[model samples]
Target: MGKKISFVSSKNRGITLDMLVVKDFFRVNDEKVEFKDVVANENAKNSLVKKGNISIRKEYCKNNTDIICVDGSIAGKLSKNAPEGKRVLIATPYDYQFKAINEYDKGAFKKKNTYKNFTHIIVGSPFEKELLKKCYNTPKSEIIDQVCIPYSWRLNQEEFKKKHYDKYCKHYPMLKGKKILAILLTGELDEDEENPYAEVNWNKIFDNLDEDWIILTNSGKLLENMTHIGYQHRNQFVYSNRTFDTREVLSFADCLVTNSGLYATYFAVRQKPIYCLKYTNCEFEKYMKRKFSNLYIKNVEDIDMTKFSEFTSENEKFCEYFSYDCGENPSAKISEIFE
Candidate 1:
């Protein structure tokens, strides 16, 4: 019939965000996506791609692959080695630290030639499309703003509930009947910089928060909260001490309190009442504020329950401006591009 659709992930280590979107797209189509460990193909077993199945063998992506989807890093390598197939470069700039932004920008500029090999460049937001056009001089026609969400939140809602709801309920029994304020924090430090969380007085936030609120953080620094004296509502707070599966958490969360990071983009797309905290000043956060007016918190003390309505009213306009569609089926659109 037609050319077989295949994906070539750049990484041999583990699953990348690009692969997740691919998995979600196939899953939605009710089509089988078979995975092979290229490096260990002799002993590798063919596995179906689904939620939680994220391992990719580099050898699986060979010269015969028809469609190769990759992040910006592997664009050149795939171009030089496998020039026959159509390539899709997905841009996920928000998934990096402030310091890494410049490196990524410069790298994209250097790899302008690789842009020619790619059939299209899929970007998450219009902002990313603009960045590539301005910084790398990538052609506007080749860029498609998908305005999608992360795989964690994009999985089939029914499947996610069936597979994860019981597990979440087992671990977070206290979460029932509470208004969740999912606070996603990046606790890790840059190569040489100080901890960004240190700038925010987390202890103060915890002390002022009531029992009705459940604080779930993805940052490792929140472990200190486990033993903090102000952490009186032990059941109300959870840390990133282990793998934090946020599928159920986001579903249960009434509102989201997070920094002006990638997770904030997720909340914005969901149109959830979001309170964006700016712990450290960065160009990205400044850009977010300018684009999504009055969405930023001047101070942590300003976070009140009453602001949800005002925030919700602005979400529709904000998402529209960015071309982010919370209701859009990303997999359907992505599949059209590849198939």
Candidate 2:
């Protein structure tokens, strides 16, 4: 008998990488699983696999495949169109235009009901599991939380740190000697969706910076004329509009600040000092507070540079809630069922 899984994603690289992490886990467990990469509604001769940079074709989903994932984008449409298989979803709901649970005004009910097609749904948090149950009416049993993602398997931490150091030396050579303050910004998904953090006046936020700031953004675009000019160029503020390698940036960061999103969950797993840039009424805020209450920052003015120097109770709490115990592989648990 052959075990096969077909991973499908529309275009988001992040989701595709998530699928790759899952693929890596299965291979490590000695599972006889053949993986296919399917790009919906497009054709490419060959593509570089996100993990290990192996090259492969954009293959079509084959019959007898056990699972079909509508990763990140095009969940409703692709899931409906996919062939008869065990459908799965890898999603992080943000209550936006591309939200897993959409708004009622524009076919939210119809869209959410489509989730019943999946045999399982993978999420990052306990809060998401409850949200899915409450909002999408998904069965509790189908939502699985395997918090120990195979990120290290995808890219080793040492390699990530080396790349970070190389990038720093080449691009932002001025940023040295000062403590690194990493702020993760949101990526572009839907243009029409209102951003809750838009109310934040960035100029006011960065006016009196306490440390050397590194803006880690998805899009490679930063504010113009924002360069610092002084004799102490060694501790200047800089930004990278590039898609962040989370572990690499975190390896050298003295403090971490981000909005409540997938990256916040990633940060929680590291058991490091974290400062959450609060977004009112955002679904992620609720989840972050539930899992990382001690890390929650209520005010932008209250972001303390000194907090990074010490450990907090939240670090232990975060690990307890979000991290897998030592020598315990949640991926192996998932493979036992999914494979």
Candidate 3:
């Protein structure tokens, strides 16, 4: 009989995508491997079905499931519920576990050992693995350092353009013959329920941009706020409420300006020109700086707009450092463990 693997993750689209990638790899490579998705979020389930035509299993049983692959530490809670003898594999970044530990330190979790349920943990890099070991004292045997992305491997410029250029041009006709600048800024509500981005100097940032450049963003809130600012280059701004894949927009973009998060990681993996805005002194941001010091811009004033127009060979180095461990086929690497 073949192995029955159950993939699990929270509502996070990125993490869910990771699980789906692994599932897809199994389907293509191993006919004997039977897989099922066990996502709890409706949006995530819908995304899986929409992107891969994958169906979700309402529930999974230990007797039927040979292994439980949990994507991200946020979904680690699922591991505790797995059958006693069932193997649980957790693929996560160090920041997720770091945040959970910080919360646990502040009495958010009742249990002293939150990772007790995990049989093995997969991390992106050796730096991440070392961080986990320092914090959780997790043994080296249980930690696997592998690159984890939604795709089989990082695509070169030619391959990336070939895959997404036509679709992107069709969807965004107005942006044609223009320098596309993609932005992924996360929005958050303040304690008093006021718009957090209202204080930003939107006019200062957009007013200096050339007319030939179009600003593209995924955050609708940012679009709404920037539109209200009535900047000189207001017409050059475009918003994508995730109507299409972000990768499509990124494919043709001359450069990307984003805050520290998964989007930055994705852009880096593509070997594209990117600038990370330092809005806060978060631990993750600090770690990113240590890895790629030149990528960080202090603030809007510090942004060297000329860099966007100039392509450099530095991006290959960034991808090399960022894509350490997992290499081109992290999905296949993980699959080999169970095979």
TM-score of each: 0.67, 0.61, 0.69
Could you give candidate 3's per-residue lDDT for residues 1-339 as a string of tens digits? 888776654333334545666777788999898776555543445655534322232234323335545433222234335454444454444345445445544556443244444556656544445545544533323666656444424333467566676666677776778887887665344556654455567666666667787778786555556645564565677788668877556546778776645555555555667776654455455644655567776664454555655556565665544545334577766776776
Q: lDDT for each of the candidates?
A: 0.53, 0.51, 0.56
Candidate 3 or 2, higher lDDT: 3
After superposition of all CA atoms, the RMSD between model 1 and the true structure is 7.4
| Candidate 3 global TM-score | 0.69
Ranking by lDDT: 3, 1, 2
Clashes (backbone N, CA, C under 3 Å), per candidate, total: 2, 1, 1
Task: List runs of model 2 lying over 4 Å from the truth.
Answer: 11-15, 26-32, 41-64, 68-88, 91-111, 152-179, 188-225, 243-252, 278-303, 307-327
Task: State in Å the error of residue 222, model 3.
Answer: 2.3
Q: Candidate 2 on 1-339: residue-level lDDT in tens?
A: 567776665443434545666777778765577776655422233453342121221223323335545343323333234456565665543434124333332345443553554667765555455556655645423776754434422232456556776677576675555566776655453566555443444444454455555444332223333343343432445666544454456555656776645554455555666666664436555545555567776655455554544557765565445433323344454565664
Error of 3 at 10 (Å): 5.5
* lDDT leader: 3
**Winner of 1 and 2 under TM-score:** 1
